[model samples]
Target: MKTQTTVRRSKYAPSVVTKNDLLELLNADFTRECRAIYAHAVYAERTRSRDEGAAARIARYGQETVLSALVLCELIYDYGGTVINNLDELNAVLNADRVADPGWAPETARRLHERAGQLRSAGEPGLAKRIRRIISAKKGAVPLAALVSGQQAVAGR
Candidate 1:
């Protein structure tokens, strides 16, 4: 029997990702989802009076992000891990005390893409495929314009 704890890098991890790499990825993703929900809520609250449409959209997005977090949490548990619950860890940057930094979501997507590539290179193609699905669920990089103008940013919207 083998037991594994969090190990830094893990780039040399086996193709299966049974160690801490995939666990770490899933946890990081959960943290991102938490940040998304927080930012969306803040934006929605601040924009409600001036942009009810955007507020509503933000609320919906927040809900969707919650689902994403739950999914990631489930994965973490199934993979023999605990969901990180550090408040200070779920951090995001906003401008004007209201607007979400335009780069946040796309940066997240970019990191996820990079992680997927790493997983593929490490011989964990199946896990890489899962990450791709999460990226596809975003349609593409979320444009700040969509949040302000109530544009359809999510795919099939």
Candidate 2:
């Protein structure tokens, strides 16, 4: 079985993404999902049984985040995009404060929704729907936040 891969094949990636810019958006979404994985893991750890039920839920969310990443990898592979293996890139930006803070969850979910919409417009309705469902189900894992008035939230913030 041929298991190894490298950037040499990146040039083979399809250019169908040009018009819809789906790949770029998906890449950004993947990054956010990765950050969520890290953040949620921290949440699970620090939650410390403040509420036994809530703690279990938080830990489950971390698991869901892992699942999302797996699905995302499949999507990338299907679309002829390169899979990102260096998670350290994600870890570099996620600081102790951000990991412990649940505030980023709502924003993360929003970005995923936006990407799913783009995926649909780009003729990827099934993938888009899958993304939506995964995101919706994981909302509890994400911390709820009140939207800021008179300001649009920036992605990956």
Q: Candidate 2 lDDT, tens digit per residue, 1-157?
A: 5556632534423334463367666776677677766655554554454444544665676688778888888887787787665557546345634644445766667767776766776788888888887787766444412211101132223
What shift in Å separates residue 9 of candidate 1 from its native position after superposition? 17
TM-score, predicted candidate 1 vs. hidden true structure = 0.65
- Candidate 2: segments with Cα more than 4 A from true spot: 1-20, 47-55, 89-96, 99-103, 140-157
The deviation in Å at residue 157 for candidate 2 is 31
Alpha carbon deviation, residue 141, candidate 2 (Å): 4.1
Q: Top model by TM-score, which number?
A: 1
Task: Please provide, for model 1 over 123-142, each residue's C-alpha lDDT reduced to its tens digit, 9 standing for 90 to 100.
Answer: 66776777777778776435
Clashes of each: 0, 0
Cα deviation of 125 in candidate 1 (Å)? 4.3
* Residue clash pairs of candidate 2: none
Question: Over 4 Å off in model 1, which ranges?
Answer: 1-18, 89-99, 118-126, 140-146, 149-157
